[model samples]
Target: MINWFDIRDYGAVGDGTCIDSPAINRAIQAAAAAGGGAVCVPAGIWLCFSIRLASHVRLHLDAGAIIRAAVPGAMGAYDLPEPNPHNMYQDFGHSHWHNSLIWGEGLTDIAITGPGMIDGHGLTSKGPGAKWAKRKGYFPESMAGMSAAELAAEDPEEAAMQGQGNKAVALKNCTQVTLSDFTLAKGGHFAVLATGVDHLTISRLRIDTDRDGLDLDCVRHCVVSHCRINTPNDDAIVLKSSLALGQVRPTAHVRIHDCHVSGFDPGSMLDGTFRRTQDKAPDQDGMTGRIKLGTESNGGFHDIEITSCTFERSRGLALETVDGGMLTDIRVSDITMREITTAALFIYAGARMRAPEGTPPGGIRGVRIERVRATDVDPRFASIIAGQVGTPVRDVVLSDIDITYRGGLAALNVPVPEKPDAYPEPSMFGPLPAWGLFIRHAAGLRVQGATLSTTQADGRPALWLDDVEAVHFEQVDLNNAAATPPLVCRDVRGLTGEMVP
Candidate 1:
């Protein structure tokens, strides 16, 4: 029998109104005092402020147990965010660790398991730029005097996150952790924010959140498997290498597989409703939940593998290292996407050196993606592989891919700008000139056995290349547009390919 340290034995009343973090902390302390054991949080509504974690402790929540984050007020408040001098390099939410519902720093051999729920309904999720998804493009006049049709933007107001616990579970500088078999609802800014942690395994969790589902930054030797993440507002599962730990720590040797990422209506996944409520464009409010890497690539990424994942009602896969990080040796395969909103695949390398002022531009090399099948994808943006003028993305291979685009858009005559310092997004350069694939500033690219098709008879070329070097294709079926060329090449060198209609 497991000698569980029950929280109820330590003056924890499992009522919804009472603040139970002190009792829970006492239970954890007692478990640590006894040289580590399981801590039992039985079934009830346990309202808490901040629950700190210790080493070698497994918090097992029973069935129907709910650890709801308490509202910050006279009743109680969470721990204040410790000052981070390196806070200027990243967003405000990514800098702090202690201002969370459950936080741990510098611990070892910890686990948070069991089939319970963490409902962060009262946590602070006040998005400043736009309102919720209801008014997709409507902006109030109070939003800096901009009207509804302008599509205005605003910088994040950091002072607005005053005393609000924005993350459900936050860990920093820890090791040998496992989080499994739980349900997270309404996670405020990020459901789980893990940085500088190693040997972490996150599996079999259902996360339906408002913003990012899992933000793994500066982590090493991690495996994320068998998780279903739904985030309608931001990224679902992202790997970043921010300068959050006050140093350059690379995220390496990561493997993610057997996961399902989506962008559905909030609270629909948990309630089993599974509704697709947002009807606007992908950039508006509801459809950005895709697997990605970096907008904070300070330390770089290496030896990452992603396989056997499904995407639905979401944006397509993206790989980015714009903040001066080397993204290399990425292998992704066996992916299927349906109802994709934007580009089916996007790879970019830029000179956004968001690190300490002198960081150089990053490189992307040795990426192989195979057996990807996407259907009913957006037509405005194509799968793009782009780099800057001198530093081009190198050595990419795409094989055995099939994609179907909803392609009613007419090709417009416009020059695609190389936004070297802009945010790395698939839709960064508006409507692309091609309907299938667009390549720019790349080297040593090989495409084999691709079947690109469109539903609505697009007017753009199937393949467009510019300023690229050493391109090769084999057994690729290009679109047969009437009186339009199947391929458009400019400033390209050493092109050797067999293309068929």
Candidate 2:
């Protein structure tokens, strides 16, 4: 156990009202310059500017220690590091150069551990700017002194920028990192963003953010366990890969277990994919799903597992390959979800039809979902949407699952017209074959030991299969309080259900 105070003879300095960001940073730098060691922040309210971490350093905040972000503009100016090639689409905004509440880059074996809290002061930092941007229909014209338009107009590929948004912690190109036993709150963007790193572990952490709780991009072999991530914007925990089209570097072998995620609203979230239709330019937008893949899934994802997790009041689940990328060998088991408003699972392969599109059409094969239960799902649009327009979903199995729907399930076979004039738009856009399990344009799907129930008047069939092939259902139960047929099959063949058609 390396003691930070022993190595550098450092101690706590709290004036009670003012921040000690620079002092703590200087001490940490000095200690790191000598060799690797820990930098401890003793219990108290330490108002700080941004803190830049060094390699081989451990920033331990003692219990009850609250490290708050300094008032905006308190920290002096600093140069923005060069753009990380891995995070091109992630807009850092204007303040990409200055310090963060806690920031590090190219680090290894660093950690922030303790039973304490780190606040980003985002209410003060982001409220005015975000409000003004909303009114102006863009970011402000100027922030602090720099021209907001100039900053926004500057080419991300060429601009030398620093920090933007009051992030609590940002780790870039780091390895062997651990952040545990901390309460992170009120971040400007993401509470914790680990990019291009490996062997990372974030556990026993409570993250309540206005944005994403944990955003992992291009990372490998990571584990996020026993954490409570509550966010109003994007996914509570999101794992992503390359953004460039046709890039296939796969964020593989990741595991998320024993966590509670809540409050994911789909309407307000962005998936972080920017596509221009005429110019084929890329911009930033939030990707959908509480746990998602590809708006930027250029690199494929494989060997990922999510188990023993609980989701509350979520919009959706397991959004795989929205823009275009392959997702395989993924397992979701022993998961319980409640109060879901949207489809429980969405496997989309549509390409964002932009000029100079970069993504290739992708598919999901060898995916398994077992022992999953959901309740209070809006039946109107709650069902799995799998397979692409051309490349149908294949080799998927769902077993031992139970879903209680408050509304009804929507079919996944609505034809997406490339252009509005491609087909005569029909009236009475009827509810898409609302059912318990709806499968369309999929092949080789095996569903076993599942149950679905709903309480609605004029309830439709519990199971609806349309335009599908090679389906096998064994011991599946589709029960509703209302009197309705249990199964509906349209334009399908080779389908078998124990209860019959």
Candidate 3:
């Protein structure tokens, strides 16, 4: 007793030219009226405006089908994300979901399963332009430069939707969701943005986008697997916790595995053809495609695991919790990285209080990264784990890791900034104190069966420590020919380490 509602029956002309959102939405309504069923989009280039999903409905796309997003204008064909006071801390594109081409809110048992393509051909990641920013006359004189509560008091209807053409698929407060086997091209700000969702599964996706491939925010109990993503302009897979939900909702219990991410040409990865159309250095070009947790950590993270992932021509692995959340019990293993422009691994805990005022800095603890192999890493920076002044990252373990880098001579007395409140980035610290690994303001660090080698002669030491405690290295080898001492320690307490020079 399956109820199947086809879009073509609802007068959807899939000829790539007409606006078919009304007909597709009609089909979805029909299916929803029949007590939850499948709404099918057949094989064609179906142009649409916005497709909102209902509960217990699955939107399935046939092969060779493409849902193209329509362009917005003064007539308001597209909606803007709902405005909030916390949005000023984050970008406008990261604030809302209802304005997207496909979106769901407060839904249950919904899925967008596909073997087709979703092309955001006419979406803009940049927020409101100068003209739209000037269109705030409806916002009330008393509401000007006021708090979120104050602004909401003046305008209870929330008639402000500033930015347009942002995300491709955005979901909020959803559960038991699944997104699978879809190809996305030129996905605007983010290809997929999921927030406050539980029991979610995203797999077998081929995405070649202009911006971030997938952004999981405030999600719980999720699994992302078997995806090939190439974004020459932004991160491939990113996890974030922003204050968009009006409170702290940590992203936890997540597992991501068996994914291939690269900074290759946009369409090359999905076509099974490797092409290097990007001419800029992978790191220098601002095309960041890596698996990262937190540049937005107001809510914090917990119990996350990423394994068996491969990265090529992209940035390295990163873990950061800078806002007022506690990051704990994270493990990453079996990672193979090549041509990394940044450090092989970067873990940072800073004091960027992007949350409400008086929110304390976050913490990082119980992190384990093992069985990693990185080759052709840029030597300007080293693998780094740095905590803030008052709080140090605790109980970190690195085992069976091999990194071959392009290390050269480190200049004398390179000053690294302890930017506790600044933005957290690997390159933001400038040239690292060590050529291989730099440990700062950390405790209980253990490195076992590790090897750090250089492709060229380097005058810097292989390891350096500052404000660190209880560091023990076992069977660690520093394969450097020109360095005088393999290890350098300053203000470090309880260091029992000897490198196999």
Scored by lDDT, the top model is 1
Q: In candidate 1, how many Å is residue 214 off?
A: 0.7
lDDT for each residue of candidate 1 in 1-501, tens digit (9 for 90 to 100):
455899999989988999999999999999998889898989999999989999999888889899999999999788887887877567667888898999999999998997999989778754243221232222211232344354333334666566788899999999999999999998888899999999999999999998899999999999999999988778999999988788888889999999999888887877889898675332452287889988788888999999999999888999998777899999999999998888999999977666666678888999999999999989898899999899889999999999999888887789987777766777778789988999999999999999998888888888899999999999898653434678999999999979887
lDDT of 2: 0.62
Report the C-alpha lDDT of model 2 over 80-130, residue by residue, as the tens digit: 434433233324422132335687878898888978888776322231111
Off by over 4 Å in 1: 126-157, 280-286, 479-483
lDDT of each: 0.85, 0.62, 0.83
User: How many backbone clashes does every candidate have?
Assistant: 0, 23, 0
Q: Model 1's lDDT to the true fold?
A: 0.85
The most accurate candidate by TM-score is 1
TM-score of each: 0.94, 0.79, 0.91
Expressed as tens digits, the lDDT of each residue in 1-501 for candidate 3 is: 768889999999999888898999999888888889999999999988889899989999999889999877643476656655556455556678888889999999999988999999977644431112223222222223567675443233323344356789999889999999988888887899998999999999989887789999999999999998988767899999887787898999999999988888777776878687685422243346789998788888999999999989888898999778888999999999998877889999987666666787889999999999999988877999999876999999999999999877654476787777666767777777678999999999999989999998888888888899899998899897784688888888997856688
Quote the positional error of residue 429 for candidate 3 in Å.
0.9
Q: Provide the lDDT at 293 for model 3.
A: 95
Sort the predicted structures by TM-score, highest score first.
1, 3, 2
Model 3 per-residue lDDT at 78: 66
